[model samples]
Target: MDDYPVHQISEVVRHVGTSDRNFYDRYYFNCAPRFDGQGQSGVDGPFALIIGLGQYPNLGVADAFAVLRRGDDHLVVRASKALGEDRMDTSVGPFRLEVIEGLRRLRVVLEASPDNPDLSFDLTFTADSPAHLEARHFDRSLERVTFDTQRFVQSGTWSGSVTVEQVRTPVEDHQWSGNRDRSWGVRPVGEPEPPGRRADPAETERSCFFWIYAVLRFSEFVIITILQEDADGARIVEDAVRLWRDPERAPETLALPEHTLRFAPGGREVTHAELVFQRRDPSGGLADPLRVECTPAVACYIGVGTGYGLEQDWRHGMWQGPLTVQQLRRAVPEIAPWERMLCPVDNLVRCTLSEDGGIEEGEGLFECAVIGTYPRYGFHGLGDVAE
Candidate 1:
């Protein structure tokens, strides 16, 4: 693949900058149907799709997975293959991703396989808002660098068709929207190693991770906010920016945004949330705070079987064999056991937002993760459910 005229480094494209075995580059995408006032999809049934592809340079592995959620049923298709020098070949078995245009358009295809005719899709994503580069994610645990990565986000409209159980459904750009993230560098991938002596044994009990990432897109602009906190409720990472639909307009960064989340009874599922963004005046004085209210419509559990890792046998960059493909169909009722075991359950929620007193209705994604001990949420330790 480096033979193509796209080399930036003196070494081959496969030769990454780092020698770390966990060095990786990945692409993640998600799309959900927009519901009308009646809480129904434009078509027959509501559905959401989450797809990802990852490459581990040093590990010599590449993998991809596509998950389709329709109502209570989830269909997952995963594939893994040994990495070759041709990094351009992103296909694994029947799944492949195409970069139609560098940053403007892309396509993902999951061909119907006879081994599992459960789900397949051919979706094209077109960017509706300018790509926003997020803050670098750098975290160290036990004096070891656990996560160091850079990612860019883009919200877009999707158009294509999906087939599930021999039934085909059309996805229109006007009625469906999604967000994609391209992240590279190092993070936890492949298999887990044996745990050595703990740097601090007491740290396990106080461990907590809270993350809230939102990409709310309206006709005029898009609101992208991210908040991450540690066990003590101290901010680890924060980003709040508003991007306009027009390319020329500059982006606005909110100062010290605050969030208040309301979870369902006895569970960590967020029912709604309120985000307050304080704007700064040109004189460097604090201006009025902009408030946005979010109400969720549909939710998808993203960590179960699609390689995010939650009691799942398959994981990204893990060498299963030369080539492997698997499928799973899970009913929502049967997911409770896995849900309880997984900490910081990742959820992709389709939500409607209302800003200020005007009630400007806009639909987008509200992604939240809450795990372990957080005093602010009344969760003091692991296995402690919300009231």
Candidate 2:
């Protein structure tokens, strides 16, 4: 098997991260079955499987989880362990994530345990497009700050098998499509205090956010977009990339130097979005525009299962070796309710995109978070008061 470069391993073990208490390194991926032979409407899949692993160096903890969503059925398996001295060992209990080749391929394995006999998988991901790095800067006020963040995204295919309830489903290379992202830096994690004690008066007055990120894969090419807006619907950051893959050569990125995005009226439950990308001519002149229309079909709260924000007992990276997997499963309700709820920070949305005079559809993740006070989204304090 291939191994990650030495420098990559060094970076993983580097203990001198920023001083922020929220600093973290994480791996995230989502996979869904490809659309059938029919047209755009034929692109319906039964489920989406999302897996994540996070390491909090400052806190000396690491965690991992897998969430499977099929219609109304959502199953989650999570595990956490102490950071220990060896950060290079990316394993928590039966969960292990390995990089086969830097920026090219990865292997993810989940072993079946008595506590979680219903889920397990051994999968490999091979990148089909070049990784796209994102700009990271969010400075609204002294109290609300986000900085020093770095992220890269790639669209790929999965090969292997997923065992659910002992029923194995083979994922052939090209039969399933997915996206994976690696991010490091300061962000909110762990549980929050009770609502009464967590109120911040200044946050509710002017704090709101809207974010959209999607990677749509077509037969010949892929389009990726990431956009963010503040409470008043003012643009904070935006960018889009068009990746074209040729059968005989490496994929190329078409420079979309200019782009614009418009979200539908309702800020909370965003169902529609319109995006236009403009490439510049060799002489730096504006060229014809390419437009994409999007509609969301399903969404999963980032805080649920993946553990962006949850109570201490249910949070990602929480120690889990004390209890058996089955005991942990039985204690889930004591930590939080199982019903679907909207969180302020992140959400993974499966959407359909229409472009290029043809309607090709795929699912991508989208996140909208308004951190301080924004009455429009019904956020009154630090928590998600909107729902």
Candidate 3:
């Protein structure tokens, strides 16, 4: 990599700036068949797929996972490999990513795994709007840095094919839209560390009280908002913005964003939500607010077997030897008992933006997680249900 004159420092590309074992770079994407029904869940259409790839330079490991969910069938395929000096090669086993044209076009491929021949996809992503660089995410637990990362989000359309249960379906850009993000930095990955003065879950400092991240794509513009609040509803990490496809137009930063979420009966799964983004007055005072209503169209539990939160045996950056690939398929109802324990409840949310007696409709991804205690939502502790 040094021969290409792209070195950021004196060392080669393999030598990362940090020696922290948790330092990692990752790419994540999610896609679903475009919504065409009358607010239906799209269960009759193609399955929704989520793909993730991560490389831990210090840990010398690279891994990738692809998960597909449609109605009752849930399928996941994960692969891990020993990292080599060439970090440029972003392939692990049968999964690989191709940067067709950098930020403009990208492709993700997952060949059929012999162990689990039920799910595979080859999809190309074309950017619909310029990528939005999000605010830097930095958090700490006690004195140790837990998350220090930078990420960029983009909304796009996907074109290719997906095969599940040996049935291949074409993915047309006209009927499929997706969003992706690229982030890299120090974060928790792999196995848990030894119990050395571990923080208590009851402590507010150690728990994530409330969190919501959304990337909504409309025909003319895109909206991206992120919120992380403490148990008392104080803002910890927050960002709100509206982006456009025109390069001449700058990203609009929203102000004083608020959320009103309605959870399922006694559960934390968000059934409906209304996001209010206030405008800034000419003198920088508070102004009127713009409300966006969201409803879940299709839901995907991310932690099922994708090595995300606490759902399975494998995790990102974990060493699984030279090369390993595995797949899991389960009936959706069988996993319900433990599904609620997962961190995020990913949903394809249809959004309606209402302002000045007018409405514009669109759809995108809504990633949400609420645990510990969030008084704003009436959650009192870990595993507490919404009332």
What lDDT does each candidate get? 0.81, 0.64, 0.84
Tens digit of per-residue lDDT, candidate 3, span 120-219: 8899999999988888888776689988998999999889998887888888888888899999999889877864556544454335547789998887
Off by over 4 Å in 2: 1-13, 37-45, 140-144, 191-198, 246-267, 310-312, 317-341, 344-387
Total backbone clashes of candidate 3, pairs 3 or more residues apart or in separate chains: 0
User: What TM-scores do the predictions have?
Assistant: 0.94, 0.77, 0.95
Ten consecutive residues with minimal summed lDDT in candidate 1? 340-349
Worst 10 residues of 2 by lDDT: 324-333
lDDT of 2 by residue, 176-196 (tens): 778899988876665443444
* lDDT: worst 10-residue window of model 3: 38-47
Question: 124, model 2: CA deviation in Å?
Answer: 0.6
For candidate 2, what's the RMSD? Answer: 5.4
Q: Indicate whether candidate 2 or candidate 3 has the larger TM-score.
A: 3
* Model 2, position 230: C-alpha lDDT score: 66
Ranking by lDDT: 3, 1, 2
Off by over 4 Å in 1: 1-10, 44-46, 337-357
Residues 1-387 of candidate 1: C-alpha lDDT, one tens digit per residue: 655897777888889987888789999898877767665466555467889999998999999988776788877898999998888888988899999998899999999887558888899999988899998888887887877888899999899988888888889998888899999988878887556754355867888778888888777899999888998778878889999999999999987889899888777888888888998888989877777788776667777777775744677788888888889888865778437335343344444444444556677778888887888889888777778
Q: What is the lDDT of residue 274 in candidate 1?
A: 85
